[model samples]
Each structure stands twice: as structure tokens, then as C-alpha cells.
Target: MTMMTLQDDLTTAAAKGNTADVESLLRRGAAVNGVNRFGRTAVQVMMMGSWPVAQALLQHGADPNVADRSTRTTPLHDAARTGFVDMVRLLVAAQADPQARDNQSRLPVDLARENGHAEVVAFLETLK
Candidate 1:
């Protein structure tokens, strides 16, 4: 089997909420926007449900607008999927595209609604 690339390891660790590993990897020159085979970056993976990891990745230069391959999902999409209101706010504050659409043409707000996050759906409305 081939050794895991730094980007792959970083994304997996971030998805699993390993902040220390993410930090060490970033400090060691891991690309913040590096994509794995799934086109998911450390930021998107970390943004799943961990605000601290997402914030750390952002502070380390992770691009909020980086899109995945299939859905072209952004960190905002991941944050919305997890119903993380704070992370959503942070991404919006960082100028994340509120109108960014996935392959299914679903925006972050749409995902928030579909996921039944009333507060998030309301918050997105205010943004628009």
C-alpha cells in the first residue's frame, strides 16, 4: 500500500477532530487547501462539527471557498451540514460565498433548511 500523503493525513486527522495533528502538519508545511481524492481539504473535513479545528485551519490559511470535486462543497457547506452556527457565522464573516452552489445546486442555506436547523435557516435568511 502507498504511504498516506501529508494532505490525506491532514484531512483525515481534521475530520476526526485531531487538532494537534492538524497544527503540527500545518506547522510542517502541509497545504491548507490540499485536496484528497475526494477533493476535500483539511478545512472542509475539520469544519464538519469542530469549530476549533475549523478556526485553526482558517487561521493557518485554509481557504473557505475551496470546493470539493463532486459537489464542489465548501467549508461553509460542511459547517451547515453539521449545524454549527458559530462556524457558519465565522465563514460568513470571512467572506465565504453565501451563494456557492454544489453539484446538486444546493447552497449552504438549503442544506441548513433540509437538515432542520431552524436557527441556521433563519440566520441565512438574514444574510440574504
Candidate 2:
């Protein structure tokens, strides 16, 4: 398959929480940070759940800070909003910016707080 197809497939796999497929695509040289037409990277989509898939992507060099073009929301934003504490931690370890502001100029901590993710809030506060 073409490199573009691999990338697009990787994005789809991530969205569906298919960790094995993600690993396969990566092994075959898919661009780890590849985004779709909307600039939605695999890392960002994987943030919805399936830490295993997210971890595989991250381990394979997916960028945790690549934001969506429309929302300017990074994987960190999604992780924080969803109260995925472990995902947030993993993203941070991958060098995601906790203070990154989206199109709405809101930080990850703000999202965590608004979403009632107290642990995420407390963790992000330390980064500021």
C-alpha cells in the first residue's frame, strides 16, 4: 500500500482502538504523526480511550502535542477532558504541553476542571 494509505489506516485503527493494526502500520513505516484532512492525528483520536493503542502509538513516536486544525486541541486536551489520568501522564512524559491553549484559549487543566477531573486538575497545576 502507499504511504498515505498506511497513514490513513493508522488513523482509522487508532480511532477504533486497534492496537495491533496500529503496531503493524507503524512497523511498515507509517508516519506516526499523520493527520487526516481535518488535522486529527492518531494520538488525538486514541485519547478517547484504549490506552494500549495510545501507548503503542506513543511508543512508535506519535506526537502527543499535534493539535487538530479546527479546534487546536491536542491529545493532552482530550486526555484531560476525559479524565484519563494515565493517558495524561503518558502524554506529559511524551513532552505534551500542559499549558497549550486551544482555539478557545483554554488549557488542559481548565478542561480537566470543567469536566470534573480533579486528579487531572491537580496534576496539571503542578506543570504551571
How many steric overlaps does candidate 1 have?
A: 0
Clashing pairs in 1: none
RMSD per prediction, one decimal?
1.6, 2.6
Candidates' C-alpha lDDT: 0.83, 0.85
lDDT of 2: 0.85
Give the clashing pairs for model 2: none
- Top model number, lDDT: 2
- Error of model 1, residue 108, in angstroms: 1.0
For each candidate, give its TM-score against the true structure: 0.89, 0.89
TM-score of 2: 0.89
